[model samples]
Target: MVVLGFMFISCYKGRLLPIEGKVKFNLIKSDTYTLLYMETEKGYPNFNLTIEFNLIQHGKTVKVELLGVYELHILLPAFGPARGIDSLMLTNGLNNLLFTYGSYTDYYAVQVDTCIHVIPIITKFTVYDSTLYGGLVRKPNIYLYPTSPCSVIVKLSPNGRLVKTIPDYDDGFKVYAYPDGSISGTPGYLFYEAEIRDVDLGTNGWCVSQPEIISFLQWLLPEYGFNPRECDDFIQYWGDKLTGSPYYEIYPITLEQIDLICP
Candidate 1:
């Protein structure tokens, strides 16, 4: 079974363990998912590490023991094959896992070995027609931020065909960015369109009244790292569209959710 990613933290009941320097995480790829095989370095024989987390399908706390160079078999599905389009809300029971020492009381955060590659962020948009229920996602403004000035390559492989893109999204968007987050010496993001029919608008979000939209966004946007100008722009763009319904149920799409959708 394909399992999603799990966030782990290292903890000790009394004294912190030097597991970071002693242990290593090796990614073993299987047909379905990538398994995290943790091994303690040589000379650290009989060194035991205990990990506790809830199982995905069953809500049971499973405690696994980690020995030196033994295959721990921690399946992290985040690095696995994409779940594809229809898998809208892929929830994981093992969102957070903790490594504990003796007595399983106090928790200490330990560093995990980095053994993974980074991928480009795919920014997608969908416009749902509540009355008709679904429609095309037109002109989605997608912004990309790089460390320094560079050319960005964007590949469009949506479930549906890419209708249109400004500046013509050929192979990629070749432009120089700055430290102040300006693209090609100008400001703004990418825009696009895709067929958004039969998409399920899940009921896992806030149901805010029309009058509460502004104040709600004022508090919400900042928490998600949105600047003042970006927040104002987002509010102006989406706030005007909420006039139809008295109460709008808005869901905040997370990065993990987006990765699962268009990975």
Candidate 2:
């Protein structure tokens, strides 16, 4: 069984050798009511965004700081997020949400306190579909990091929903970027190595027919759009329940699937 969503297929080192893309970054959002705007008189640089998330109904901030983050995706998507959300970013503030991996579905999203968790991939080779030799190629064996040693295993429901999060203070990461626009870090896990091209996130919580995952999602890729969670978000949020959960290829599942997980 392909445990981590990676197939044991024979990958070929194609044309460009180490085909690469930079760790693109851009601001997603910020609050004007937060301290970020209140401390302007002290100069913009003096602004310290200590509050990661909004103060909730509990009347207390969650004290949230992403210890580590990751994602999964197909080797390439046929068509995916909103406007500039896809571009690389370098935040005006030290804090920002790092887009770990994105393509058609935007499979990855991490809520980090200090947006330093940038895992920029450095491709080692273009892994193409062996026998036929055309269509799409993946850049594997890429190296990424400057990580800290903290473990916070967060499992999401596919549409960027938080499924589970287990953190170990010693097993956390401190991710940062380098001068060349590449990122480097020592994650709670061995994150120094990463692939540049899109990779699989995995199939643990949702239902998906392995043979049809790509071709199926691809066929529906261009025209399918509905609700805040459709297609990839639906996939990521609910995840693949394997052969039994809910087959998207046969009939596309709806946002209603979210209710299925309710307590």
Tens-digit lDDT track of model 1 for 1-263: 12111111112122223332233222222234333333333332212223222222212222223211221211111121111111111122322222232333221222222322212122111111112211244334556667876776666655445557665666655556555566663346656665432233344556677678779878877877777766766777666544433555566655554343333
Error of 1 at 53 (Å): 43
Runs in model 1 deviating more than 4 A are 1-135, 138-140, 185-187, 197-203
Top TM-score model: 1
Reference-based lDDT, each prediction: 0.39, 0.24
91 Cα displacement, candidate 2 (Å):
26
lDDT of 1 at 41: 36
lDDT of 2 by residue, 148-198 (tens): 433233222222222122221133333344333243342222221221212
| Structure candidate 1, residue pairs in collision | 10-108, 11-108, 140-192, 142-190
Error of 2 at 193 (Å): 30
